[model samples]
Target: MSFINYSSREINCKIVYYGPGLCGKTTNLQYIYNKTSSEAKGKMISLATETERTLFFDFLPLSMGDIHGFKTRFHLYTVPGQVFYDASRKLILKGVDGVVFVADSQIERMEANLESLDNLRENLEEHGFDLDKLPYVVQYNKQDLPNAAPIEELKNLLNPTNVPDYPAIATTGEGVFQTLKAVAKLVLLELKKKR
Candidate 1:
């Protein structure tokens, strides 16, 4: 559901970052916002609760490049990771062009990661979008932590479909852009296919 603004000759695509609570989805967005040049990005708006958990979603409009004559703009969003925020999550996913699932790599959060992934599938199904058909990628965040699960184990548990995945440390910005770029590339390819 990419939006083509004829007046501005810009194509706006939505890419949602989703994961369990405290899985570093917001951190990924923040890092991208901080590192992106001001001219290439629009203002980033983030809504969070007192504990710094995302209450809604973080919105960052970024200009990736141009397709034909239209400027390609990706509006990156991260759904609130809390379980109670399921309704908000569904709403934010309505017209998503791509998804980045940021899974917490710590051994203790494995269950949470699985639950969130299942929730993501269910929510996408409700919106008439199959996760299998969507442009999706996985990011194993917090890989720098000593307690992080092994990459093989994480892949076995989280990426059974073998979609593009990356190991990341969101705080220090490792693999953040790589994950973003991979998903964004998929999204752009999808767009090209549709055209």
Candidate 2:
């Protein structure tokens, strides 16, 4: 559900970064917030629990260049990955225009990645969004870790439909922009089709 604010000449789209707990979803958003020029980004907000250890959500607003005379803006969000926060995850997914699944690359986290992906599908379905039809991409994060899983194995398990996927070390910003660029391109293209 992209919003066209004609008065502001802006097209706003929401992109959610989803994955298992500590899978670098938030890191991706943080890297982008730090690297992007101030003029191209808005405030970066992270909502944390009372203990200051629990992350509730992370939000960042980004402005891409205009398309067809309309300024394109993307609001990036990351849902809380803890199992107890499943309800919050579903809520964050509502009205999403695109999604980026950040899969932890460690071999031991494979099962977690699978479970999270399944959750994503189920939650998206609840919102009347089909995973197959949505503008989506996968990011294999923490690639620099010594125990990272082989890219081929990760691809076989996570990207069976062959969506655009990128290998990224989000902490260092490697492949971060590429992952964002691919999904944002698909999102803007979808907006054009809708128009």
Candidate 3:
């Protein structure tokens, strides 16, 4: 969804970080929140459980360098990935202009990653959007883990479509910006098409 600030002539777009359980979606957001200059971003807010699991979502508003005079504003969100939280996931997918699918790269978690992607597709279609057509990116998160699958294997199984993909270690901030900028660029291009 977009909100036009007539006084400022700016349009804000929403981008969601979506993925499976414990896939570092929140960690990615946290890294960004920490790295961004305070003058350029808002406070990070989490609607979560006592155990730190996302109960609803986490939100952070960010600004990119001005584009064509309008300072690009992005409202980032993360959905609860627990299977029981399916309803919450569907809710957050609404009004999403772009998505970053954070995939756990460990070999053993391959099935979970695919299942989550399938769920994402189904949920998007329910909103009348096609996954292939959406402004989407893939982040093979937790790449620092030794048990993680090789990037080539992960790419073959997870991103055969060749969407812009990033190898990320979210906790240490490696590749986080690359993922952010990739999706942000795609989102802007999508908006440009609309104009």
TM-scores for every candidate against the unseen true structure: 0.97, 0.96, 0.97
lDDT of 2: 0.93
- Residues 58-81, candidate 1: write the lDDT tens digits: 999999988789999999999999
Query: Which predicted model would earn the best TM-score?
Result: 1
Q: Compared with the true structure, what per-residue lDDT tens digits does model 3 show for residues 1-195?
A: 666676896879899998999999999999999999998899999999999999999999999877667788999999998889999999999989999999999999999999999999999999998989889999999988999999999999999799999999999999999999999899888877887
Q: Which stretches of candidate 3 lie over 4 Å from their true place?
A: 4-6
Pitting candidate 1 against candidate 2, the one with the higher TM-score is 1
Which sequence of candidate numbers ranks them by TM-score, best first? 1, 3, 2
Clash numbers, per candidate: 0, 0, 0
**Candidate 1 runs further than 4 Å off:** none
Global local distance difference test of model 3: 0.92
The superposed Cα distance between candidate 3 and the true structure at residue 109, in angstroms, equals: 0.8
Q: Which one wins by TM-score: 1 or 3?
A: 1
Candidate 2 clashes between residue pairs 3 or more apart in a chain or in different chains: none
Q: Give Cα-based local distance difference scores for all models.
A: 0.96, 0.93, 0.92
Task: In model 2, state the lDDT of residue 110.
Answer: 94
Against the correct fold, how does model 3 do in TM-score? 0.97
Model 2 deviation from the true structure expressed as Cα RMSD, one decimal place: 1.2
- Model 2 segments beyond 4 Å from truth? 50-54
Model 1: worst 10 consecutive residues (lDDT sum): 48-57
